[model samples]
Target: MSESYDVSYPGVRVWCRDESGSSSLVVWRSQWTPEVIRIETPTIYNRTVWTVGQARVLRDVLDAAVRCAGGGSW
Candidate 1:
């Protein structure tokens, strides 16, 4: 089985997917950051942020839910 979900709010977007026993989430945001690089004129630049480690952490949480709940560690 497989499932996917998407959530968007203002300048943020989150995508989650689960297939078989693997799950992950990808988060993206549009905002001004130091990582932005000028693409057009020197005064014009684009800002984008993509997070993957956060998604992996969330997936790990699910794998360790039992331990977090005071159950035996896996």
Candidate 2:
């Protein structure tokens, strides 16, 4: 199962998922200038950067997750 939350900052979102009883938290942030997505996985202390297009795909996935959870303002 998965859950998502809206961050205080605009264009930022966070989510967590449980798979086989393991949980991971992910954060997505939209950056300025060249335009990139910053992804952070706190469980493993890992970070990755993605292009705007890639970020949009992830955003869409998160949106679907929110919808599956019955929708919310966050």
Candidate 3:
């Protein structure tokens, strides 16, 4: 099994390994950034940063998706 966080959007899947200890560091990637999967393994990895605003936007979008999909806990 892989140790990573994942989320599915309308037509996309985003994921990233949980390697950081900081609460603010959320590195994620999707089909558009294949390098995230190509380079990262259980022992080695890379990260792409998202700004606070970007992260918040993602959070909001995900919340909306969940709401539309019959409302689930976030």
Candidate 4:
């Protein structure tokens, strides 16, 4: 099987990647952009997840899907 991440805009749609390897987002997609993000701050027991910015462009588009799905709000 294969996987995909379909990124898009109001009047535009783009597929950024097709095939790839897997690793922590910190390695590749680092430092965060306007996109919704999962920040795992190191803790004694586990990691804390969070969102960094409030971008109106794709506010509820990409990463927001996780938060809206009750996957820990930022």
Residue 58 in model 1: lDDT? 54
Candidate 3 off by > 4 Å: 1-46
Inter-residue clash pairs, candidate 3: none
lDDT of 1 by residue, 1-74 (tens): 32453333232233334444443333333244423221111112323233556545655886698567886532
As for lDDT, the candidate ahead, 1 or 3, is 3
Model 2 bad stretches (over 4 Å): 1-33
Candidate number achieving the greatest lDDT relative to the actual structure? 2
Better of 2 and 3 by TM-score: 2
The TM-score that candidate 1 achieves is 0.26
What order do candidates take by TM-score, descending? 2, 3, 1, 4
lDDT of 3 by residue, 8-74 (tens): 2222233444565322223345566433322122333434345556667766997798889897643
lDDT of 4 by residue, 20-60 (tens): 53322221123334344433322333333344443333446
lDDT of each: 0.39, 0.61, 0.47, 0.36
* Candidates' RMSD to native: 14.3, 6.2, 13.5, 16.0
TM-score on alpha carbons, each prediction: 0.26, 0.51, 0.37, 0.22
**Against the true structure, candidate 4 has what lDDT?**
0.36
Clashes of each: 0, 0, 0, 0
* Candidate 1 runs further than 4 Å off: 8-50, 66-74
Candidate with best TM-score: 2
Candidate 2 or 1, higher TM-score: 2
